[model samples]
Target: MYRLKQMNTLRNQIFLGFMLVMLIVLGCVGFFTYGQVSVLLRNNAEKHIQQTAVQAAGKLDVLLRQVDTFTAQVATSATIQRLMAQEAEGEKTTFAERQSMLQEIRKHEAYTTGIRSLELYTTDYRMLFPLTDVSLNSRVPQEWINEADAGMGRLVWLGLDPRNPDVVIAIRNVRLIDHSFSYAGYLMVQVEKNYFEFSVEGESADNGSGEMMGLFDGAGKLVTSDFPEGADVEGMLHSGAKTIELNGSTYMPIQKRSEATGWRIIILTPVNYAAEGISVLRTVVVVSVIIGGGLFLVMTFILSTMITRPILNLIKVMRGAKLGTLKPISVPSSAMEINELNNTYNQMVDSLNELIEVVYQKEIVQSRTELKALQAQINPHFLFNTLEAFYWALEEKGEEELAEIVVAMSGLFRYVIAKTDGDEWVTVGDELDHAERYLKIMDMRMVDRLSWSIEADEECRGAPVPKLLVQPLVENAILHGVEQRLGRGTVLLRATPSDRPGYTRIEVTDNGPGMDDEKLLALRCSLEKGLNSRSEGGNGVGLANVQKRLMLYVPGGEGLTVHSSEGQGTTVSFEIPNAHKGEVES
Candidate 1:
């Protein structure tokens, strides 16, 4: 019982809730921060390794291409080609001829650095540099010779020498620059391993990071490495893994292939180096969470006491409110929100009795007003009959024109004021009739100063539209466009099947002076505002009101458009979607 009572205390509950929320938040933040930081560091490390490998490979390719160019220069020299042609023609070369060829080979040795040797061989089986050593000739592999022959004059990389394993080899077959284009001889260039190793080492030393790189041949054999000896290079190169475990340490491997030499350059980066930042961040996060949790618990205790003490005082004061005593009670607290809350409660208490009395008075007045409104109601049919009686009385007195005006007025009133059961939709023909009556009344009232015409498609006459849809446009035309002009004006009402399917176009055009750009712009702005505000129609509906009503009544309706130029006629048009309705009696 005592534990339950303690748990029910408001200050204890608030402190426990805040502590629980803080713990969950810290745990989630730490988890996500650890995962995200680790991934980012790993990616950055791998990207660095990849860039290093590509740079090294690019340098090596430049050196190898230099050697290739030198070989091409010697193979295509005019003296060497002529001598090779002589040898191919079964002519025995004199010592002077062989010496000329030896000079030609020696001239190219200085073309590029790190060149171990350059040898040229013909069908006669002679080494140009060593003159009499068959061992130099014997060292040339038959497979290299065949591959060179198949090259048809283009250079091909033969990779590291298998016998010595310390030399890089390249060869190309030469062709005579003649009409026959006959095969000449083979030119082989041997590059020292130090040529490529020097570049890789220089790049590694410049980086200053403890990362190692190795160059592998096309067959995945390690040709040279900046890695320490016996570093399991073969397993690292062939395992095809992104990360490797070497000596119980993690390393990320990035490999790039050289387009020039078809060799693979592999770089290995220490994972520990990349994760050092992650370790520091982890320690900071742990310490911050512990310190923040302790401070949050202390603050939660202080805040709960400040909050619950005010609430308890307010509760004690509100106990009098339930007994129908309408009196203000004040609760003082240091918190701004608590003080504001107390002020609001006191104001509500002071206004409670006044509000009850005011509500009672408003109900009595509302009942009396409703009774008067009911008593003032009249049948719509009586007004229609009275107008008809006035029309006939004017006709009997030989005032035919006045009688016609009276009939049109009666129609205008009936259509505007009468309810069509609960349905707001009417046929286009009925709406046109309403517009015609309104136009007739306006034209008669203007003393022959106003005239109107309506041209409607027979098919469009039966389409459904909101009642009074067309009458307002005609009224607006006569009042604003025609009456505002100096002389007679004409209003043309056109109804036709719209180009858009399942729609009808209605246009009201006036021949009075049109609006200038400024007035037209203001009028358009008014219509747009009306559409947004959804202003409903009144007895004196203007263009904006008509547009709002059209938008409300017609499905998929876009309201109205006005086109006008100063001193020219104005045209207002709108499209209404066709709606299915019951047939109307003629």
Candidate 2:
């Protein structure tokens, strides 16, 4: 039952439904936003890598062109040519010629820092001048000479040297100035690896960025890399793919090949680093969603409460109206619709109260009028004078029992009819006296078959009750109970101070044949049905009449309670306020 009620509340329904929609909306927006940000970051990273590769490749090209230009100047020099001719002719060069050739080459090397050493070789593959470095032997290989001669005086990039892998070597063929253009010798220039590193490092430093750069030869051999130990340079260069994954990290490789040097500049940028902002963005999005959802829930609770509070209050008032309580809504709501509804309910309550007031006044007037008409049926003065004559005549003949019967009958009729000009209220003591007079007549009629007792607490004796209230029950007791039974019957009437403050309890019990469940139910139903309903023939009319009159006197009262079974007697009871003077007047 608790679960059922929880499921049905308007607040829960609205709050839950709104939260569900919020979650879906936030989830979709966050998901798509995070995806787009990740893509944008990756694309920007790739573009940066491409830019770095381009700048590095351009610098390498410029450096290699500078080396080629320097080599060309040396090859065209008169001193270097005359020396190469001396070496070609198998002549022992003079010290001055040797000093002049060495001075000229050393002079060019001093202008640029990239050149480590320069060697001039003859057509027979013999170096004319060699440096003291062990890697610079006074010999040239057949393949190196053939490769240089094939360039026809143009520069040829030989990549890493076999003797010293750390040095890059380039060669140019020296030729005669005449149209014959005969080969004089070859000029081999050795460049330190630091020159390439300088260009790449300069570009990276300008951008305040750090990434792995590898220079690869046309043959796909790795020349130099910034961090060669940490990466797979050869594998990445030969993979033929734009991206590489190594050590559990994905990297995007941007490659630019230098046309002059036939060298590839490969820059590897880790994809995760480029997308680092995505992680922060994801955290922000989640927190925003949670905070937004929490605020929405609070607002939903407050709004739903505002909407449902007045309706619940109206329901409570309506439930009270079922038990004859009518009250207007005293407080208004912030919402116009709910306020209007409350106003309408209050208007309905006013209209219903007015209708009930009209009906109740009419009923009171009709009840009094009918009561007066019934009282008029017997001429009070004539009946009273006749009973007086009979009472005196019987007493004169020394018949005391007959005289007493006449006196009781005259008192009963006087008590009932005497209040026709006044309100229908009487003290409990007076109603009990009237009931005793009626019971005495009933005892004379039933003789040995009837017996009764009338009792009242001292505090209840002066309590007000409607006129003729107790007598009807006494009459009903004698007629339906004592008269119907063959054996002797007993009837008891009791009035006591009620447990409730300023109220009294009255009971009428009779012992006779009693009633079966069906008959008892019908009798109780008749009492509940009120005066308009026809009662079953067995004492129902009198019992219903007494119940109806009690309710009329005490509006909204539970008129009577009947307790009965097959062989047990029946007891009927009612409670009345001790003070009913204002109630009767109104």
Give all candidates' CA lDDT scores. 0.79, 0.78
Q: Write the per-residue lDDT of candidate 1 for residues 427-527, one digit (tens) a residue.
A: 88998888888777777778778988999999999888877778777777776678778888899999999999999999999987889999899889989
lDDT of 1 at 300: 95
What lDDT tens digits, residue by residue, belong to model 2 across residues 1-586? 9999868887788878888998899889989998998889878877777887778887788888889889888887777776776666668666666667788988887778778888866666555666332222344455666777788889998778777888888888888664266777778888998777743556556654556788888778778887547677667657687677766767777778888767788887776667757889999999989998899889988988877787787677567656766788555667788778878888998999899989999999999999998878678888899999999999999999889999999998888667645557888898888888888887888678888899898899989888878777767666667677779999999999878788898888898678999988888887888744333355434777777787778987788888887777778788888886555423
The TM-score, computed over Cα atoms with residue i paired to residue i, of candidate 1 is 0.55
> Which one is best on lDDT?
1
Model 2 CA deviation exceeding 4 Å by range: 1-13, 82-100, 131-147, 180-182, 199-209, 228-230, 240-251, 270-273, 302-586
The candidate 1 region of ten consecutive residues with least summed lDDT is 531-540
Q: Which ten residues in a row have the lowest lDDT in candidate 2?
A: 131-140
Q: 284, model 1: CA deviation in Å?
A: 6.8
TM-scores of the models, in the order given: 0.55, 0.46
